[model samples]
Target: MRLTHTGPAPARRDDWQTLKNLWPYIWAYRGRVLLAFACLVIAKIANVLTPVYLKDLVDGLGVPVAVLAVPVAALVGYGLARLTTGIFGELRDALFARVTQGAIQQVASQLFQHLLALSLRFHMGRRTGGLSRDIERGTKGIGFLLNFTVFNVLPTLLEIAMVTGILLWRYDWVFAGLTLGTIVAYVLFTLLVTERRMVYRRTMNTLDSQANGKAVDALLNYETVKYFGNESYESQRYDHDMRSWVDSAVRNQVSLNLLNMGQGLIITVGMTALLWQSARGVTQGVMTVGDVVLVSAYLTQLYAPLNFLGFVYREIKHALADMERMFDLMANHQEIADRPDALALQAKTASLSFEAVDFSYQADRQILHRVSFTVPAGGSLAVVGASGAGKSTLSRLLFRFYDPTGGAVRVNGRDIRDYTQDSLRAHIGIVPQDTVLFNDTIGYNIAYGRPAATQEEIQAAARAAHIHDFVTSLPQGYDTPVGERGLKLSGGEKQRVAIARALLKSPPIMVFDEATSALDTRTERAIQEQLDRIAQGRTTLIIAHRLSTIVQADHILVLDAGRVVEQGTHADLLALGNRYARMWQLQQSGEDK
Candidate 1:
């Protein structure tokens, strides 16, 4: 499928604002950061001291040429200092990495948790591949900013200050002033150019996500693609996305190259001016050959970090952009969570009731009217309706997946919303029409709701679902992995596993939405038999397309366009000869054939 791109490109101001939200996670690693800074300071001092040692060797030992050993000894000391600095520099980088990793993981974990906690409505509106890409991209900002800002940019800026101080002390103010002015110009220019170029980079990033998302979609629907023999169509679609990604990438690269070349020219000119001034000082007898050497050495030492600072600044900007997206996700105000004082559901009666409930997926269109229904204690209620008649919407409200826009859904005469979501859902079991299975062992899938359930309990549930013998007959028995979305198993086998899972929950309120729809006649009979046994002493809400499945229900609700058009027992509804009766007759006619 050709995916449509939505939304505007990430704005720079938005990105900067996003980074500000990450202060909490960054501040948490301050202790380790301080130690890294201490090491960095030591490294910078060692580097600056090398220039001083060189000056001493030249001015003191050069005039007394016979004292060559003094210069040699000073050279050894300088080399040793450089070695020590390098060691601490490495240590600082390593420690900074540790801090960045921790921060990234911590923020990532929070984002993951928050997204998962968001209402199901939010999930339905978003693409899974796009969300996953955003989450992955968001973590990168933490690592990029922490590593580049602390280890590279900060140290480079510090070195500039140190070099400036030494230049002022050793010679005239001309060189120091020149150095400071040039550094400021370089920084401002780099920031300006990078900010402009990031427009292209951001475009590239967006296209990359699209490409990834397209690949994900194509792979996910591979079975359908193969069945339709549309390999060429799929390939062309992927190629189209990749072409866009490549075009964006090329534009980004060209801009980056131009920026780098311009930066290089600026650095070359600044170095030339600084050295020329040093040479003039030497010619005036206020400086010596060694003074020029000292200037050159210090320039080399400082310029390496200075050059890297440009790259680091660009990275920081990009990182902040990523940070902003992540922070936005974290700051998302999900539907307010249950109040702190929310209590567990105290279910005195096994009844489900909707009191004039209203709901809609979007405000413009109402999916459910002011619907009302009640399932008597220990009674089975069947919701029978055409597609889009709000049968599924009713089930979702009963489960509190989305709260009603008005009115309330209650269990045992208490509003479900008043109970903590966890506590309320704990007593509710569901076998969704679209059953999904994790890629895990059969036994694990069966016991998913009750992780602590014993082998006996798992086996018993499987037995009731009439799949125990088949499961044991497999090579790995209960330990066999179900493969992705249970693709390795047949439709009937997967449905049986879902039934076994819900049965293990053993909830007082069971929702069976076309539970046996995916199964063959034999498997349906077996599963229906188990469900019938479980429905005893429990309030059951069954949404059924198959007439046979709800024939024995205590009450049948026939919905038409989000309203209850008819309600009665199966025999009574048939006598009325309305929607339910018509549906039953249709199914009976098909069965007769």
Candidate 2:
């Protein structure tokens, strides 16, 4: 979450090198770019030529001028040229936006796909708000660079060069050299000032990210704020972040305005002087009035592009900053993918085994240590452990959320690593401790496990999970809308929906992770019966919290810290007077009172 304050200035070789990186996407739509470029060139040329018609009118009006209609016709012709050029200019702008939009979409899609391929470990360490902002800012850069840098800045640059060369060829070298020198000074000064101002802009961008991050974090935990009566605290914190953002914005604006005002003053004084000189030459009969008129028009036209140049340059630099962040994410090496020749598991057996497994979320502190166990096909096993003692970590390994730090886990006598990641997980169904549901119809949520499931199949699964009566009793029945994360449902209801989803998945192996640990006694008892029914014929693994709930499991492993300290059936463990017996005794004693 460290924010970048100020970016380094670009080196002499930076633009060319950076632009080379952008070239692949640019080349993809080369034909479209060329067509738009042709339109822009034609528009600028028509604009430059229009001034000649104005010059002709200024010089030829009093001469043995042709009929009055001739001058009127020439004026109309000038207007038409400007009009035509304006239309083409707009067309070029529209096409540039389209091309840029396409690039934005393409880059966004690539970034999204890359994110999906990253390991769960990567996501675990990053804030959701920060990640989202990074993605949005990165995609937006493409559109900004494509439209402003390519269409406006680059073309205006060429126009300036061409106009200066034509002035030298058509008139005195003095005028040409002066205009070139003024342009050079203008560009250099603007760049220097803009680079300074960019320091403030970069700071503002950092604050902007913080503000976005804070807001997203607060909104996601609004329920906690309400429950704790900490709304004022959250509000004050948000306001603090917002005030910082606003102060940065004000500083950036003041500096930008200073740069723009200075540039404007220089352009006004230089243009006035250039035009005054041309007029003097015309008065001395060294130049025609028409020539002076043409020169004045060219000067006016040039200033328009010149004023916009500063703004476009600023955008280009900002775009580069954004592109760098985007490229960083794009350049991240995705987690290891399935091998090229990976094969799906052959469903010959439902047996699961762990051999000398060791794992940890952080180095030097293992969660599961050299734990080896096997479940016979279609057998049931329960793992009981204190909080943070590796029960959940073992289940994660079975699903391959993380490969073992040492040793291996196997399914059907084959190392799980040998199967494609997707295929390996496909046969495992889990009812997590915290059940999550999307905002959708009840039927849709239940059908999520198998999207192509028939209505009858869905109803059957819901009935089997004992949620059909409740669902059908609702106003909209199965079509009822569940609010975000199923906030509308009770905890027990949410768990039942999850059970229904897993039942529909019909996976060969089922895992229940403290499925009833957080419920009331009555609710836990009800759900436990439903779970017992669901586990009848499958290879079931239960991570239990209440010792009573797992008494009927065929085999139970008592985990202490990171090792299996005791193992037996309920009666055997009770008779042994071990860790499990003590835990059961504590619970039973509490209940007896």
Candidate 3:
């Protein structure tokens, strides 16, 4: 695997575009959005009217009259306003909850599909811990942006607008001026301070992903670490990642405290100035106690969400930062994409061909060069070479994981690229040199080869792969859980499980890539017998290191540095006493020793 781990840059956000990406998912529930918004507006309006009732109640109570009857209407109206504000506020939340959840689900599902669709090159270089953390944060950010941007931010702004307008209309331009100026100051302070604080937040995010990546990497390679006794080294590496997080987190908190102080200072000044003006008006007899009380009431309504508004704005910025990574992942173009006119694979004979295929993982270093070969229907071919002879590249090419840099790969006389990738893959089955099983039950892993396979079919495939008897011996049988990457099972057992999975697939073309290499000699012989039976009447390609295993192949291709050095039946190659004969003699000597 290529070790260049530089992934997409995660911190930069075209905020407008990133937020716009979420719009469609949320807008898919347009009816709910509109109704929820209407409820929101009504709730804010009632919240604004709440103070108006207080003015009347205060005036009625302050009046000097013979009979001081209770102001029942004002009292009841005040209660109703509060009730309306809360009830409708809750209703809005109830209505929009589904939209929030649905958008999150849709976005998460799309991200998952995109991740799967990404090329193997990306997967090979991907830091699993980082990728997983990005996805988790991004999904969470969707919910926060959807709920708070609409509910918290918008409502606060609407309430501000209503309260300022009421102050201007009820009293005079001076009161409104103080209210608007205070809002402007508060918002400006928040935006400017929060903008500067963003660097700290972004720093925290970068370090967090890196730290998580290190932790996960260490854990996944647990056995390797134990073997080397590098537990301290791994811990030090993870701690190194977190040290930067610690710095940034401290700076983030410091900046936040600065921001809060600035906001509070502006709020205190604004509140005092407004109250002082109201006091002067009351003393001058221009404003009654009712008006002063009303102003105070509206101030409470405005500033409560207003304080929360600052926090909401900060959180929204952080949310955008989190989502930027996931969206960047979404923006990553597929290295291999289906042609617009791609056809489903249609193969009657299941013949496989590599036509002068020249390929490379990188431009500086080529792998296969004009290497051509073919396996006719119901025929088997074995590829043997020293390590790094481009053995795996051929299998990947057949699966269309990466198109050859030059030349073409054909399945059933058609360029594999002409067929949709999924369809082409459906026609081929491979048991790779390294079998990585899913962290699931034996039954689940086998069934994954064909998800619709019944228990009977699973058992039959297991028996064919010579693993059913062993599985039956376990107390849980097929229900036994394989731990992460099937680490709980031995190598031979994992190989058999892989074989069973491949058998369950029952594709027209089969590739056994060192399929028996992991087993003991006796087990290899037994599984090889079953493989020979299964390969009958099916096109098969075997990439082998053990020469004896492939002697029965109808043809053998000897590769030396990505070029075909010899090709003939096993007897013919041995008779020539060339590369294939020498390799055979060497392996025979090793076996004898």
Measured by TM-score, the strongest candidate is 3
| Tens digit of per-residue lDDT, candidate 1, span 114-166 | 88888887877776676688778779767888888887877888888989998
C-alpha local distance difference test of each model: 0.84, 0.81, 0.89
Strongest candidate by lDDT: 3
TM-score for each model: 0.94, 0.89, 0.97
lDDT tens digits by residue: candidate 3, 295-407? 98887877788888999999999899889888889999899999999999866559989999999999999999998988998899999998999887889998989999999
**Stretches of candidate 1 exceeding 4 Å from the true structure:** 1-8, 63-80, 346-349, 591-593
* Residue-level error in angstroms, candidate 2, position 168: 1.6
Model 3 TM-score on a 0 to 1 scale:
0.97
lDDT of 1: 0.84
Better of 1 and 2 by lDDT: 1
**Stretches > 4 Å off in candidate 3:** 1-11, 64-70, 591-593
Task: Mark the 10 consecutive residues where model 3 has the least summed lDDT.
Answer: 1-10
Ranked candidates, highest TM-score first: 3, 1, 2
- State the local distance difference test value for candidate 3: 0.89
C-alpha RMSD between model 3 and the true structure: 2.4
